[model samples]
Target: MTSRNPWSRPVGRRSVLVGTALGATALLAGSQLRFAGRSRAEGADPWAGWQPPVQSFPNTFIEQNVPIPMDDGVTIRADVWYPADESGAKVPGRYPVVVTTHCYGKALLGAMADYSRYGYVVVVADSRGTGASEGSFGLLDDREGADAYAIVEWAGTQPFSTGKVGVDGFSYLGATAAKTAATRPPHLAAANFGGAPTDPYRTFITQGGNWSSSSALWFALELLGVAPLPFTLNSYGGLDVQPRNPTTDIATFLTRLQTDGSSIPYRFAELQRLIDGSNNFDNGFWQERTTDVGNIDVPTLVYSGWADLFLRDTPRDFRALPLERGSKLMAIGPWTHYSLPKHIGSRNDQPIDDLLISWFDRWLKGIDNGVDRLDPVLLWENGSERWAGHDDWPVAGTSYDRLHLTGTRSGTSNSLNDGTLTALPAATAGSDTEVIDPLAGVCSRQTVQYLGGLPVYLPIAFFMPEFPISEFPGIDQIAPCFRTDDRANEQGALTWTTAPTGTDLLFTGPVALTLHGSTTAADPVWVARLSDVAPDGTARPIGEGALVASRRALDPARTKYSPDGDVVEPFHIHTHEAVLPVPRDAVETYNVEIWPTSWRVTAGHRLRLTIDGAEFPHLLPNASTPDRLGTLTVHYGPDRQSFLNLPVHQGAFP
Candidate 1:
């Protein structure tokens, strides 16, 4: 059903000659430029202190039920917001169009009014088979990407359009922008891809080869949103039958999907099939859905948060985009997926819309605002609470510092400080072992105690508030009130603590755990976390990484090697092409890449590494059943040395 796209002609990118008109508008506008207020108590708003300028637009008019034709002949529904005057009449001049497409209907999108009022035509479209659109929805199917491109081209050709188009949104809409921009749409002047990850398999479904319990819920939500029934329609005003050829059956496909959804366990089974079937490599299925960042040649703006689920790959993809230095921008904020509004609301800042307007103002409207003159990297250091800009990520002068785990295996249960993390390795061989009940980790406690475990199967809409399970990202845990219980440290975790830092230690890059260890089971999963232990003993996680023993081989093709030749991929090892399973009861040196972090461990704060068998709910427990309990042994010695490699900014230390 692939149709030749007439508008698919590639548009070569112009050499954006960014003039040196640097403005005083702080790239990441914040109050202070110090290192003290970085880390917030768990659940505190990371964006509480900073205030960004709020840009508002006036005279917006909404036009609903616009039928956009895709190459596959499906009539996708869109809500177009156009610039209007106080007399309730359309503004005469044509303006650049910004198209935001998602499975969720247009009405839920709040940004449309803002963009439209500011003299741009904003089109929020419901992809085929969702909301008011036609065709059965296949999540991330190639057709959706094609539909996105068609929608953009359709908008570009409209009389109200200035023949320039831009795509923007978060999550699904971000993904739509990525796919559409990759196609090199002739009228797509720029794109703002935020919160949507470049790699779905690595960042979304199965991170580190470990499945998430929330997969089934995601599948159910997708199916529920896409089913043909009127009841399944998204929040796009209402479920009105479109005037165009009205042959849509409201009950048939809806009943089928609902019947399928009734067996919640089967949904998980289907999800597992996709994970296992892919064998964790970039297969046809993943490649079809994933955006080839290398092919994206537009002036793109990428955004992510330290606590956002899709946070890992956004920066990586931003670096991959084939745009000129000044053409691409990356902004990493402090709020989680949910707390973004709270953070922005606390400070009278725009909810990522200010940056969007500034970007669009420069690229689409041809405004010579100095946004292009600002540094490409804008980040919020967690503990420091200050916004900083840099020419590149892992800011210029970062160096890797390794902390060695030194101590012996002692008590039956893990003590808060069973082992020490030291600058020097143990003089002699030292080993520590801990028994793990895969289903009995930190997340399990929340599921069983805090919110009933039923949230695991319920739709996110039904229980996101109490469920606390936000897919792999876990945005609920970002609240200033949310702190990991000390009980998790006692339950089957091998703890390694360091002497309090005499002076502030600024760690602002990728982190990794090199483990010379062995597990009793063949299919063991290792969850590791790097935490900041405050002077008062409250442990807050700085970053976390995991590994599934069976999927340990690195895929050199997909793996991005460091420029200096030291192989480091922040967060997770980009390994998938080959499956090198762990030999039972054998010691292997695993170079496990933990997620990246930007934090400062102030003087008197100690660093800790807790290694456990599982990070439940966040990741599905080890494939092993309860009967096959496994014991993991972490080895540290001259022969089998293990350490946590942290990217430290020596220059930032005061």
Candidate 2:
């Protein structure tokens, strides 16, 4: 959560209060006294006061509501900020312009002011229907994309703007940058997206077809805070103070009355109801908002935390863009939702602002900052060393080795065995059954600290290794145990391991499982997580994916897989929603697609896979009935055709 009061220190009044209060009162005391003080303080401008130093470069700053003309002649209002000096200077035809869209929050002028100081024209506009912009905002949908595209074009034509334009921001803003870039706007040149969600349904609204209560609540509250209405005195006093007309500014009034201590939950609940009522993915609403990556044509930089709520969507969108149109760069850091400046292990390295400066220098200024020479994939390695840059993600020269499950009981020695190579039937039938009680669902060992004593929940066992340590310490703490659990009866978790490799294996792209299994429920959702198990028994989660049983038909067009032609389709995994019913006492095996990840598993580190009926918090707890018996069988060997397909690429630079 963002802290509103940045200067409230202990033991005294805030800096702003003490400084401003004393300065004002002292000025009234006597001009002679003030002059004396000023005379003693050499080279200090009395009028400057406590304001921050001016930026080094020539800068122009202004906050104005721009009337952006749309295709239908409907003018959309945008909040624009740019270097003031560029206004009348007839210097060049091209200047780099940065366009940013607000997330759930309305356009914040202060947020974009910093960008203008960096010598670029910055535009922050509310997605149509949001803030002061005309039209209705429909979450992540087409209207927003169109408005973004229009804004990009508008920025390009501005007299002060250089034809070159770039987009940058975090979360909702990040997603907007990507969607707009995909539109292939004429002036669009580059994009940098951080923690952007691509597939909203699968990654944001619902994880594995189940609602995320915490995330949903947070989003709702933010929306309410920014709703375009005003609160009245009667409204604050619990009176029936309805606005005279439908267009009353109730949102503004409500915001004004928000005190230091307010019932945030109450406001959040109101937004939650709006979200809960909408669950259909195929609804025309979501379809209209979704972006078509096929149109994206530019250089792109994507950054996401391994433990980010939108982890899956960030990389998914990056990979979706056609390679021919844009060059893709990905950086997976160890961070949680809000911790930006802090790195893993509590280290405060360079701030995010530094990264942005370097990126802008390369894209906007056309400066050879070595950004073009940098590796396409840059990730932090835990044990071996510090952050490493690779020519391409998931370095080449990796092997696909399988470790079969040979155990029996849920956690007993009988159920535990070394997953070594062995001959098995092509289509064997066996089953293990477990019940998922929603009330007693698995809790994530990690929690995201939020304001007002609220905490974000994560899944317990299903961890992703690629997630950064700082953003998600809880998952990082429990990740190691997920692989080497010799303990007995550890819920319904199933483990499969591979022998340590002798050399580094760079496996990139989506991970898939072609299992043949069936359950009794008509609609069953299965979750799969892949991990890297170190020799010391630490399990690092790398990738995770889920499939709703009924929608088992993989979309052959978007799938990627291992050597044995094991289908690893992306689009078909959760693109469509359908319910598949399981017959009584039936045995079925359905292929499951896990989210894509890129990591180099060094020699002596084991590769692991875990299959569970439920991945709590991250996904909704499965509600499997006792009478419904669900069993999963695996078939391996050259004849049975079991292998993982990885998208391997050689280094772009030597």
Candidate 3:
């Protein structure tokens, strides 16, 4: 059900008075194409020393302070980027429009003049209440969706528009692109959504039934936007003014936010309301803020980072959007949420921006530049340091390989590196009991950290006052062993590692874990990770998944099964109704779906699986109860076997 104000007309003075009083009530919230070039193999450099063909237009002209009016009479702020000819005159023709909505303010996201150079009229707008736009923010509210629809349509009808429009952005902005596409606006031709999530409640707020504490840091960054600083918007390869809106910058945004009596604490308290599971069920609140990607019918380009926060949903989004046979395209890279700006494809020198521009050119400008003839999927295979092209996302011939969890035969009782993952069942039945400390944080060697157990590079890594290095994604984690090299000796984690492999083992699909376990407490959260253990003993995380024991039921209706109809979806039961407290003393079977991935465990390399009770910062500490600690027992054997289902790509490899 979509949210719309009953009264379509502008809110009268009386309504403003009513709005002020009701302010305390709520807090909210792939396509195919063909390419003509020969399919690039998994390990080839397609873009090395190659540059995208462009019109070579001169400087880009910016039309600042544009106000786009929505149905409810709220005006959203936007900056339109137009192209200039060699003679310094503005290009004189209706051009395809590209719009991006930003939560960090229009100025921060800025207009990518590069697109303008290619004859695209790019518009970047700030979500209402955060920048120059006027209105209360509902955290990606339906109003935002409504505003997006209006803006795209308006851009289409503009004198400078060719009635063709496209949308692009990452994270919050990526989500806005999806929302705009969902409205199925007539002029919406295509979309490029990078690092966006499908379900806001599940992936962003209460992730896997746990609160994302990192959200607080995100909120602080939003607050910091109050003071617009001159910063380089490296992602777009341009210098961007922090606050594009002259009137109400971050300070004004916060001031007006508090003037409504919704103080910072109230805002956080509302977040806590969700964290406390008060609004755990999917209802109008989540719906008002959620975008139905199935509603999006435009050709779409999807971008996902294996090390980013929304890894699981990338493929899910691709499967949802129904586009032309060859219109849906996707590229999965080895990147963190912060490292997406660098055009580097993992270690490859190819600029990701080239692929992006070619995509827009094909869809928005109707230029057949060979991008449509290429394979629909481009996946970065970690460890192999190569990119593979596939006709379908979990390309054909992908088979699930099972690895049974044998007992920890080593001296380290609770170490994750002690156990074994083998193709055969354990010779004998057994069980392992380990204590799960709710307070165990990321620094606690025993846990599987979110986004690959990597050290957080924000605030701390943003600037080294002494050395002052340029901060960017992938820069911090890859800077001289910033993250741990091995977790083999971690104390509290239970791990299972396979013996060295004689042949290269490559996988390109989703991963799942079946665990027969019991916890002493009614509520228990399980963290599972699949990593690669090099012969030298360096353990690098590949993918991870988590589930609050209570939220264990599979919502078959919403879950997608595999093409072979044997495996389960990568995610299940996101609503509160699916949550069920674990039976205190009885062992229960829990199915944990590790996020999808594409990796190659080379010869002599071992695959590892680690399970633990908690990972801080990534998720809020499990519901703590004073000094009480809980014990989790893993039951294995014929009757209660635990194993991992890894998707082995039977397709061609590098």
Top candidate (lDDT): 3
TM-score of each: 0.78, 0.68, 0.84
Where does model 1 exceed 4 Å of error?
1-59, 86-89, 110-113, 227-282, 342-348, 408-417, 443-481, 484-487, 557-566, 570-577, 621-628, 651-654
Q: Pick the candidate with the highest TM-score.
A: 3
Q: How do these models rank on lDDT, best leading?
A: 3, 1, 2
lDDT of 3 by residue, 362-434 (tens): 8898887767766677787787776777767556445455588888463323483378778776777887766
> Model 1, range 1-654, lDDT digits (tens) per residue?
001111112122111112101111211242111121222233344333333333334455666668887776768877777777876567777889999888754544534226866678888887666666766665666888888888889999999998989888776677778888988888889988887756777776666776654443356555544433322223222222332222333432354355443223444555767555443555666666777878887799988777666677787777678788779988877755444232322332444666677688788988766667666777776776666666666565555545788884322224533788876767788788877766545443223212212333234557454443322333445332234544355445788888778888877766767788888876677778767778767776666777777666665444433322223553334345455667767998676767777888888877878887766666654334342257888999888778776666532211
Error of 3 at 539 (Å): 1.6
Model 3 residue 487 CA deviation in Å: 1.6
Please give the TM-score that candidate 3 achieves against the real structure: 0.84
Clashes of each: 11, 46, 24
What would the per-residue lDDT of candidate 2 be over residues 584-618, giving only the tens digit for each residue? Answer: 44655566656555566777766666555654454
